[model samples]
Target: MSPDLLLNQENALPWTERLNFARDIARGMEYLHERNIYHRDLTSRNCLLRELPNNSRQAVVADFGLARVVQVEPNTQPDSPRKMSVVGSAYWMAPEMMRGEVYNKKVDVFSFGITLCEMIARVHADPDDLPRTNSFGLDVEHFRQKCEDCPPAFLQLAERCCDLDPSVRPWFSDIVSITTAIIQELDSAPNGKYDITSRGSSIRRRQ
Candidate 1:
């Protein structure tokens, strides 16, 4: 609760910097998944944003209260992360988790998709409308259309991440790759500089 704020429409990040939001969060989640940590509660309220120079921003994932470091059995498949308890914000939760099924890190991917949608849509999420089983078709399409600057691949990735079936979701590493590629492409594009500025601010480093 250190950041103590949720990203919402009133405080929505500038549209041009959305890619930074995607890349930074994806990178952080990739690190956690790489080390076998699952952040069960992944939401805008659990993410912190620090202003940076050149109108860029850094997003940090927080709130690990429901997080778990799955322990692998000697003979178990490496990809089969054991489920502990049904935990996580309902709106961002995967269908498997809602069903109380033992699942792997894909649940985080489902949450990531919801978070990404929030970033692009620039609105506070309502959990009641977010359960994975409810078919977020309308919500997803609305966000997709609203994100004029967002790449098609990015939107596609978000939808895939929120797939009802956990097994169908892509890995965090794959998310990192796609986000990184999109960021690079945007950075190299001449017309992509719209709304970006040199704010002369550096990230706040807490001791």
Candidate 2:
């Protein structure tokens, strides 16, 4: 398999690089969710970035080796039976995953959350200087610092993606909404000084 283009560290890239990367990832995950597919093994290595016809970069979620078709039941038992193997990166796996419990689409959400944080950090951070953490792990303060001055809408979305409880976390459709909103805000304010309260209002409006 080819290496993830976004993870390449040949040189530094602009903030837009990171934003576009995140957007592509969200889109790919949205597609998977629509098909009731859950990529149990989501990591930076599994996401590959390719240039669009317009010369913009887009992310493609790959490596479906651990993916499974999950049913969205109204009520799923925590101890339900699972057919797939229990294998995934430690840092990106959800808490329930660590407990060896059966999970659903929410597991992908948890991994996507970690991937977002990593992409944000990679935009401007030196990999060597980053805190020593596993692939699916994150340093919240470090993420906040790297994204300092980023629109609150984006920050909140990242936080929501990494929320402890998968039940409360937004689905891929909601993630698309948040990411779209953030992109719109960024386009309007190129300087990146966003209205936190106003952005919060927009998010609440969606909810």
Candidate 3:
């Protein structure tokens, strides 16, 4: 098990760890998507961690029990992917998935958003609190009131991942670009360290 993944503690997760925790998963998912494979179950537990000597964790996406390979062109519908029962974890399900509508790989983006929320909160998620109905994704209000301690850009990425319109969600390729930018910015900061426990001072809203 990945110690870095354990969030049920007294202190906030180190800010860098948030990006570190998610970076590889995004990469792995991106790679899978490039090959037209999507993991239907994308919870945190599906990720395996390699603990480094320096205590940092390296994430590997695992458990392909419900995965599917669709060889179709972009923005073009593939064969039916609908299932009889609601698939995926309840807490991380996209709003469309929750409503039993058609879903696609963008569902993984939604799950990533909730998974990031769990990482920030340092506890198991409360499904009731996840975005619902027409209000999918974190708005500026959720950012200021609920996730002030998380990196604004990081949470912003999550927010974009959770957009109600999957068309609006960034691809895994974009997810990779965003995380790389965050790591670069933090690496250039004074002392090159971000205090995970500190509340975020500013947020870059998505335009």
Model 2 residue pairs with clashes: 91-136, 92-136
Please give the TM-score that candidate 3 achieves against the real structure: 0.78
The lDDT values for all models are 0.68, 0.64, 0.69
**Which candidate gets the maximum lDDT versus the true structure?**
3
Query: Taking the tens digit of each residue's C-alpha lDDT, what string does model 3 give over 107-191?
Result: 8888887777666555454545433444544444544456665666877787777677888888888888898899777766544
lDDT of 3 at 34: 78
Worst 10 residues of 3 by lDDT: 196-205
Steric overlap count per candidate: 0, 2, 2
Task: Give the Å error, residue 32, model 2.
Answer: 1.4
TM-score per model over all chains: 0.77, 0.72, 0.78
List candidate 3 segments past 4 Å from native: 1-5, 53-55, 73-85, 128-143, 191-207
**RMSD to truth, every model:** 7.1, 7.0, 4.8
Q: Model 1, residue 145: what's the lDDT?
A: 58
lDDT value for candidate 2? 0.64
Candidate 1 residue-wise lDDT, 1-207, digit = tens: 122233433344443366567667888888998888889998767888887796656888888999888776888886784657998887677777878888898888888888777665544557443323354322565555556555566668888888877777888788878877766765554455323334311111122
